[model samples]
Target: MVMLDADPAGYVYRVLDGPLPEPSRGGLIRLVGVFEKVLPAISDEYASKYYTQARDLAALATEIEAMRDE
Candidate 1:
């Protein structure tokens, strides 16, 4: 890893030796996508249940991508 930027205000940004590996479509992101497709099949009584899990996973994937050096 290496420091890519810094400031007197104590802010800094870092990056690894190279770009972060791309997330596979058949990976976490894909899993979330699959879950979304499942939602429509679920009855309303259970729609929220599946939706929450899918939403949380999607948020997690976003957070992880944000942290990686793009």
Candidate 2:
């Protein structure tokens, strides 16, 4: 997984290279786009449930960045 530092400007675009079915590729792209758009709106509870660490916001951001980079 690729990890990136978080910034106020948010995530930058990441190019992905590989063979993937059209639907799967599209779904991944859609998920990243949606997350990028809604991330700032995510509540603490939601982040906590998925991230599981109280002080791991940085790690969570890294995971999201990696997803975008995938």
Candidate 3:
């Protein structure tokens, strides 16, 4: 699992390079939903910055999935 403040992109790349199961991999969408729920609830600027980073990480994960399907 990638920590909220850690290098999420790196974690994604590593997971992609390994023998991850299909069902577990499909959970990325749910992960994005988690971030989506947290984003709007954030009122502090500092926390919001992390929320944006989480959003980017979620996007990166989705993009990887799209590229894999191509």
Name the regions of candidate 2 deviating beyond 4 angstroms: 1-18, 45-70
- Tell me model 2's lDDT, rounded to 2 decimals: 0.41
Q: List the residue pairs that clash in candidate 3.
A: none
- What is each predicted model's overall lDDT from 0 to 1? 0.42, 0.41, 0.67
Please provide, for model 3 over 4-67, each residue's C-alpha lDDT reduced to its tens digit, 9 standing for 90 to 100.
Answer: 5454554476557863357745666666777777778879998899768767876777777667
- Number of the top-ranking candidate, with TM-score as the measure: 3
List, residue by residue over 3-68, the lDDT tens digit for candidate 2: 212221132222223343456445445544544555556578766344333224433434564565
TM-scores, all candidates, are 0.43, 0.37, 0.68
> RMSD of each candidate?
13.3, 11.0, 3.3
The RMSD (Cα, Å) of candidate 3 is 3.3
By descending lDDT, how would the candidates be arranged? 3, 1, 2
Better of 1 and 3 by TM-score: 3
Question: How far in Å is the alpha carbon of 51 misplaced in model 2?
Answer: 6.3
Please count the clashing residue pairs in each candidate, in the order shown. Answer: 0, 0, 0
